[model samples]
Target: MTRATFEIEITPNETPLLPGVGRFDFQKVWEGDMQGRSVGLMLSAGDPASGTAGYVCMEVFEGTVDGKLGTLAFQQLGTMDGGNQGLRYIIVPGSGTGELEGAIGVLNLTVDEGTGEHSILLEMSSDH
Candidate 1:
């Protein structure tokens, strides 16, 4: 497998869906080792005080993956319960385009709690 990392900037707009449910639409710009942009939609529910909120997100990334040009789609599912948090992110099968066609991988996104710096790590099949 091959791994590459990229720094990301995300802009999100929250839209209320109901009393405790809402959606967030976001646009992401990525730089560093990978240059690209992505658009994402996310749905979240619950209150901060209760600490039982959860979210699911879908994002389409169009750009370079480790200097190789292509487009990819990924999904994220996460939940925060009390002081515990869990998240899962993965590349959508057959969603790679151009040079990334037929590529299979897992994607991980991380943020620094103090700095708020976001980054993505893509672990791809070596066959690509």
Candidate 2:
């Protein structure tokens, strides 16, 4: 089984690039499900109301790939366009599966129309 948890911080939204406006920062933690390699988020652009994109970083803290400690780096999970996309995860190899228990990461979020800005707060979690 896998579990995902997150905390968000909002920022000013961009306008002329989006109608539904808001920005968010992501901080999340996960428990490995697929042999401790479980990481990633399934993103959806909410609706036609959502006219922005989403990008995030996934990092590993306490983990190993074949016994070698995992590195601290952020990989682009994917783009969350204005539509419904399925679930996904960041790959940390042997590190995420069972090597990590006190890992930390950050998520930089945005929502805009390229004119104005609005930031929102959201907390989300999932387990499977």
Candidate 3:
């Protein structure tokens, strides 16, 4: 397993998808073992302002993981309620290309409340 950390920037899309849903586009700059950038789209529902909400996102990451260069896709699901939060990030099956062919992994994310900083911890492996 490999662990990597990253920082992210999220921008809200002006175009509304639904009455109560929000759309966003995000970019991540990864560091540590995995070095590169990723772009993703997110759809969210409910109200985070009231401390309850859910979101789903799909990201395409282009980078070098442990010196192997390739691209991988990830699916992310997350929810937050009050002081509790749950998140899961999984590599999309058969979505690996180049040196990362047949890659699989789970990623965990963390946010620092005091600094409003976001980071990720990726546990990744490949069939190749």
Indicate which candidate wins on lDDT: 3
- What is the lDDT for 38 in model 2? 20
Per-prediction count of colliding residue pairs? 0, 25, 0
**Per-residue lDDT of 76-105 in model 2, one digit per residue for the tens?**
544445564422333333333333323333
Q: Pick the candidate with the highest TM-score.
A: 3
**Angstrom error at residue 77, model 1:** 0.1
| Candidate 2 lDDT score at position 119 | 25
What TM-score does each of the candidates earn?
Answer: 0.82, 0.30, 0.90
Candidate 3 error regions (>4 Å): none
Q: Return the candidate ranking by lDDT, descending.
A: 3, 1, 2
Q: lDDT by residue for model 3 over 1-128, one digit each (tens)?
A: 55677788899998968998999999999887888899999999998989899999999999998889999999999999997999888999899999999999888877788997666677887766
Q: What is the per-residue lDDT of model 1 for residues 1-128, given as tens digits with 9 covering 90 to 100? A: 33444454444565556776777777777777667888888888777578888988999989887788999888899999988989899888888889888877777778878987777677776345
Model 2 ranges with Cα > 4 A deviation: 8-26, 29-56, 61-76, 94-128
Rate residue 52 of model 2 by lDDT: 42
| lDDT of candidates 1 onward, in order | 0.77, 0.35, 0.88
**Ordered list by TM-score, greatest first:** 3, 1, 2
